[model samples]
Target: MARWHRVFRRWVLARHYRFAREALVPHFFDALTAYALELSRLGVPHAKEAVAALRELRTLPLPSFTGEVEDVFFSIEAQLLEHWGEEVAGALRRGLSRNDLDLTVFRAYLKDRALLLLGDLLRLRKALLARARAHFGVPLVLSTHHRPAQPTTLDHYLLGVEALLARDTERLFRALSGMDRSPLGASALAGNPYPVDRRRLAHLLGFAGPVEHTLDAVASGDYALELAAALALLGTSLTRLATDLLRWAEAGAFLVGESLAQGSSFMPQKRNPVVLEHARIYAARLLGGVGTLLALNHNTPFTDLNDHSTGVLEPLSELLEAGEGALELLWVALEESQFVEERLLSELSPEVMASEAVDLLVRKGLPLREAYARVKAALPGVRPETLGVEREELLHWMGLEGFFARREVLGGAGPRARAEALSEAERRLKEDQKRLGALRARVRAARFLLARGLEDPQAEEGQEGEVG
Candidate 1:
């Protein structure tokens, strides 16, 4: 019983408290400085000394506290009092509440995680582009409902996968959009009494603007849910791709590289696609995390509470980490895996082109139903030469290479269409890279300013201009 209690306390109770200290204390110290500076501007006595003390204390290691306190802020408060004396350290909490501080911490955590996830997604997309380009003309059968549906090139298939992930990337950006606002000045579900410059705090924190409503800012859990939802969707995408790769490899249509495969201990001929299997498991965990987070927040009072705090947010961190791992593993798997061309062609199932054969007959002035009926009346996997068209015409309509040529429409799995799509994807990736670079620069500038104490509290405009 004692062991069980210890396990629960260590794993469940104090885990996020530790996480908060490590992940949020640095950001909190900067916020504390901003609050102190604001208090000074309001003619609060000795605020500068307190702010200076807080800035100096920021250089010290994060405080380690016993498990008696479930919240990191209390531990931080204790540490501040010990170092700065009562008078100076007391100013740290002048116009802020644990509520507002928590909001900022959670937002900052989500913002950083979202950006990191975005970076991983971008790299995965880049890997897909590389694979697509490498196998530009490699033909394979396109599957629908778990069966061969049509002929398509490997590059075209990879481009389609990239398109799905591109949208996932956009959704991640949308999650970041929701996190762009700062919740610093929303003190305990109400506006701070001190003349605080929320916009300046937001700028210092690398947020685009301030969340206007104090109550809404402190109470909102929708941003976390949105991010979780997006991450779950990304996990879904990875799962589908992983499942397809696994199925193809199992069918001997795709070959997993030895670098990515594992051999069983006793099974001599085993070449297991362990990476893909692990990718699938990671994807499932991401989805399961979403469910856990949703349930944790469900029916809780829609206000500042422990339920939606660090503990709830911790699962999201796990999910995002899992998501990043799944993406990276799948990217490596895709990059190393090869298509068994003969096996791929053999599985094409000549009957998969029966519809195209019917289309040929229709163009020759037969009714749609009549064309389909005539084609169906014939034996399964009928030779294209036996169709009511000239040999050259039959090849044009039903041959693997010719099938791709006929699909010249935009977004089609044809040579020209895929080439154009690949080029466009590359261009978009370059643009996204620039955007990410700019964002990181802004964050670095904010960290730099925070580390050095604010020289002029009123220099908001200049400082904001320097960032972004």
Candidate 2:
């Protein structure tokens, strides 16, 4: 049983340890420094020794440890005891608990990961906008329920995708903002009795501020859930884009580049769109990760349970990793893809222009249902003469350029509306870029404070800038 437990520890719990070492350890060191400094300021005993030990420990390589130390927090404490003796270790941990410390580390780690994912999302959006601009007025047959429904431009379709992703981007930013508060001073499930300054701890660790309620700080997994929800929405948007690209590629209206294409092993002539396929697969995995997170947090007592805390770490990390992969794959796919203009134009059959024809008849003083009935009866071989319209007028309505020109309403599929929409999309992209820059700047300022072990007045002022 002892041997079995050791193997289980090595195989099953190794990732958790690695995550702790890689993602949480640096932040743990910073948190310890912040706490020691706060204690020194408050005239706590042994605070000076704690500070001195941490400074030296920072200079040396992080000590290695065996997995038998139980968890990352304990391992760090054990190392502290081994290296600096109980006086320094005990002083630093005066009011600290794994519950609050782990929560704080998780938030810090997630903030960095969220920033990276935001950058990838922006890159994908930029790729989409570039493609939309290049194919502004190219004609394509828009479909409803897998049948040709109307005529639209390639740019319009691409912009629809951009709009979806734009919302996903907004959601992700909101989630990141929601999780920005520090949870460091909420020792265990209640507020600690020590006079540690929570706000100072927040500043040193790069958080907006400490969470107001200590109980809520330790108990709430809503922030993690919010992030998972945002990722799930992003996955949905990516899947839709991939699905459309796959369909269009199969229909010969989209040309997948050789670099992104793959040849089937047995088939001699197959340029499969493997990038899009892989993107969709990654999206699926992201959604699955979100589901796992939801399941972990479901129906459990919400007071500092592992179900909502440590249990969520791996799933959330997987979700972020999957989201990153999907974003990158989609970006590359979009960059390497092209609209087959000839194929797109060829696919726009006369039936696709039927909606415009019906509108033309209604404008010619015919009742709506009567005009629809006339156009319906004339189908399967409808002609201008059969519909009792001038040959030139029917030709104009059926023409792709004329089809785009006549529907000049705002948000319509007309060229003018599309141009307006494109301009608006460009403006929103710029605003989003500015917002992302501010977020990154604030995080940098916080890291600077953490590294210096003292708050800079200028850095604090800079961190005061709001993301909105």
Best-matching candidate per lDDT: 2
Estimate the TM-score of every prediction: 0.91, 0.92
User: What is the clash count for each candidate, in the order shown?
Assistant: 0, 0
Counting only residues 3 or more apart in sequence or on different chains, how many pairs clash (N, Cα, C under 3 Å) in candidate 1? 0
Question: What residue runs in model 2 are displaced by over 4 Å at the alpha carbon?
Answer: 1-13, 58-65, 458-468
TM-score, cand. 1 vs. native:
0.91
Q: Against the true structure, what is every candidate's RMSD?
A: 4.2, 4.4
- In the predicted model 2, the residue pairs found to clash are none
lDDT of candidate model 1 versus the reference: 0.78
CA error at residue 273 for candidate 1, angstroms: 0.8
Tens digit of lDDT per residue, candidate 2, span 1-468? 243366657755565677677667777767777777767666667776777777666655554445556667677677779988887788877888878888888888888899999999999999988998999888888778987788788889888999999999999999998789988888887787786678877877777888989988888788888999899889888998899889889988788889999999999898899999999999878776667777787787878455347669878887899999999999998888888888876657777778777888999999999999999888865577779999888877778777778777877779889999999999999999999998889878766665556654643322221111
* Weakest 10 consecutive residues of candidate 2 by summed lDDT: 459-468
Pairs that collide in candidate 1 are none
**Candidate maximizing TM-score:** 2
Looking at candidate 1, the ten consecutive residues that score lowest on lDDT are 459-468
